[model samples]
Target: MSVVDVSGATTSRVAPFLQGLAREPIVWLIVLIFAVGALTSEYYLTALNLENLMRNVAVIGLLSLGMTVVLLTGRIDLSVAALMIFAVVVGVIVMTEIGPMLGGRWLVRGNTYAGPIIPVILVALATGTMVGAVNGIGIAYFKVPSFIMTLVSLTALRGFNYVLTNGHPYYLKAPLYGWIGDSKVAGIPVSFLIFLLVLLGLIAFVNGTVRGGRFYAIGGNEKAALYAGIKAQRYVVLAYVISGFCAAVAGIVFTARLKSVDAPLAAGYELTAIAIAVIGGTALAGGVGSPWRTLLGSVAFAAGLNLLAIWGIGNWYQNLAIGIVLIASVGLSRTSRKKTHS
Candidate 1:
């Protein structure tokens, strides 16, 4: 009886409970929202709506992929949406002028702006890569805070988008473009198929590839990584570039499917992507997450938002809900980390 301490008993009892709670907050949130969604709307669980929900999210979902890689290194890219608009506009212009020369014509839904599938894709991906290079150079070599650097680009890129569009939407009249967005493979949107392919590829890159593991190391401690002979700067730049390429890929799919290109196609999308990255358990401080969690996180986020839309929640209220969820998730993540540390 001389040294029996109540603290030891408390620690033993609380640790397991806290550990389980910490392990999967996003899963809990997803379950809770999904159940609520099912109860509120009769159409929530329908087959057609399910397809639409997944297809609609594919764009923002794509952005989340890039954001996942960037956040791992404790950086952010605010210009992603702008870059998307730029890519869409550029691709559409190239397609309309050159498509006829290469046996392309607007056929789907009475639109015809996409050129040859292969060339359109190459141009879009290249544009995205270039944008990422600019962003990376600003952050890595210039020693600029990612926030400031990306914001400047966002502002400037929006202007570029406006310059290209002249405030008008460009429609693609090609059957190919329409098919990319609306056609199905084994009964799934081809765009959705593209998303799955890209997501899976990225999952492998972030989880299995050597460069992926090194990204985490760069995020965790640049100095230590440098000491370990890791080319931290080069990899970091590559991350931004990859992120850009992802945005471009998504852009090509979106423009092709919609048969339309506009300056505002992806407005406010970066916020959604950033939110998904955080909710998926990626530490804002960097070095604590991956693509698997991000993939689920994107689904959870898009599903929840769609639930609100289906339930007839007002747009303003939807934004409020998003804000609330984001704040609460971050708070919960912080608490979980503290408990784990203690």
Candidate 2:
């Protein structure tokens, strides 16, 4: 065959494969959510309930986005929860600085501007980036396995958490901060809106961006990518950074919901994120899934939790449910399911 003909055939073959791979998960999952939600509960079909549910998943959803990247690299980061706790401490401290506490020990409603929100947001993002870099550096440069490196950070981060807050619960003193957690715009919760936007942007990036394409390449075959001169270390660092940022964002959502902070916050969140990632159809072996699917897994799992909570299920049972999901999710690991991995 002529060179031109060969090139055209290759392009045609590759284009359709990418397009089909991208389209199926999103289309099927959206339809499935509505279909199932509509059947199970009256709350599921309502606009308000779904909005709250989405808001509920937003923080974890955000974290799972980063987990998706980490898992994509065929590596895992176990310290995201610690960083999240750290970010909440920073965010609460920033909130106090923005407005004085009304009762010395308590914050009365209808009070001060919760700080610009941007500063806290930046702090969260920055903290996440730094934490991720630490994980990436340990794994990529020091030759540590990602699991061990992140586990070490997990211990250190938990320590930093207590030090940051001085072992006290921190509460925001500003009323404006309330907007981030509970306020609605145009009849929809802003927190949920932000989560949706972030989700959509991530979906597009995974499907279209050059850097994102490299993520899939690295996840699919890191050795091949290295041989092809792809900057593997750079992408590894970027993945951890993204995961860290996700943890920070998740803390924002979480603290906003409670309007309080604990040094031990998100102590088990990293596992939940990983579980969501796995249940979302992302394999533990890496390179076979996307964010939206991870998100769908999150929604299905989260909604089930909420339903359980509403049914008056005890916290003990709730723990058991989560454990089941985690165990089942790990079944999707390449070690167990060879066909799924392929």
Candidate 3:
């Protein structure tokens, strides 16, 4: 073959591959993170370290998954992290105070308070859902901007968190908490398993349900969705509700892992969740992402942080890196979107 023909054939073959990678940067980002992590430290490649990494990122994973759903519906929830902390705090209080009335006894061992685990779990879920419902109602019914509404919630909840505990940490003791946070089945961390299960169910829900489609439609263009007879307001509310519920679940996992809850326990986690969703290829403008993508983003993000820690990078630098990555990802997404439209 002529030299030109050879070049043409190679270009044709490689073009599609490049396009595929562009369409799914999270995949390559994850590969890159793992590669960097393996090179940065001898311990990074160890089985135990990787397992710990997965377990630790489970909370962020859940939060990011929830953020992705909210982003899909063209909304945002800045209060999720605060809600997580607040919900867990409420749950623990319910277990410690309300449990006694319900015949649940507490045995203090050192600084940890032991009580019935059921009340904590139930109250946390309820607290999260209630907060989420309020957020939804304000945004959907009152037509409040999502950012403003959630920001207010974030502030209020954060203050309430401190009020509930008087700026101190509350340590709790429970077998189920330990199991959910630390135990493993067949060598897999239970926290990671829970994250995986939620990921799967969310995938089914967002991709398989009619309401899920409505979320996408509203996100893509609310006016058109409304014209099509889709209830945009209801779906938007549902999205925030889901976000709140996910935050609550994450709070449970986080409190379990630490065996404690504090005002600052999950401070700034909402930003991490947004970073995860955006890095996972979810468009901030909405209607262009999935749970599977968020999973890859979460893994990549966790791996990157692990690598940074192994390299002894400081928290300030890590935050800088997150900001850089978030901006770059959004830029790339917007560029790709423009190109597609053009």
Candidate lDDT values, in order: 0.81, 0.77, 0.87
TM-score versus the correct structure, for each prediction: 0.86, 0.81, 0.91
lDDT of the structure predicted as candidate 2: 0.77
Per-residue error at 295 for model 3, in Å?
0.4
Tell me the deviation in Å of residue 206 in model 2: 2.3
What are the C-alpha RMSDs, in order, of all predicted structures? 8.6, 6.7, 6.8
Prediction-by-prediction clash tally: 14, 0, 0
Model 3 stretches with alpha carbons more than 4 Å out: 1-23, 103-111
Quality of model 1 by C-alpha lDDT: 0.81
Kindly provide the TM-score of model 3 when superposed on the true structure, using C-alpha atoms: 0.91
Backbone clash total for model 1 is: 14
Give the candidate order by descending lDDT: 3, 1, 2
Location of the lowest summed lDDT over 10 successive residues in candidate 1? 106-115
Best by lDDT: 3
Q: Write the per-residue lDDT of candidate 1 for residues 259-310, one digit (tens) a residue.
A: 7778877777888788888888887777878877887788898888898788
Candidate 3 Cα lDDT to native: 0.87
Q: How well is each residue in 210-325 modelled by candidate 2, as lDDT tens digits?
A: 88888888888999999998998888888888888778878877777777777887778888888888888787776777877877777776777777765678978987888897
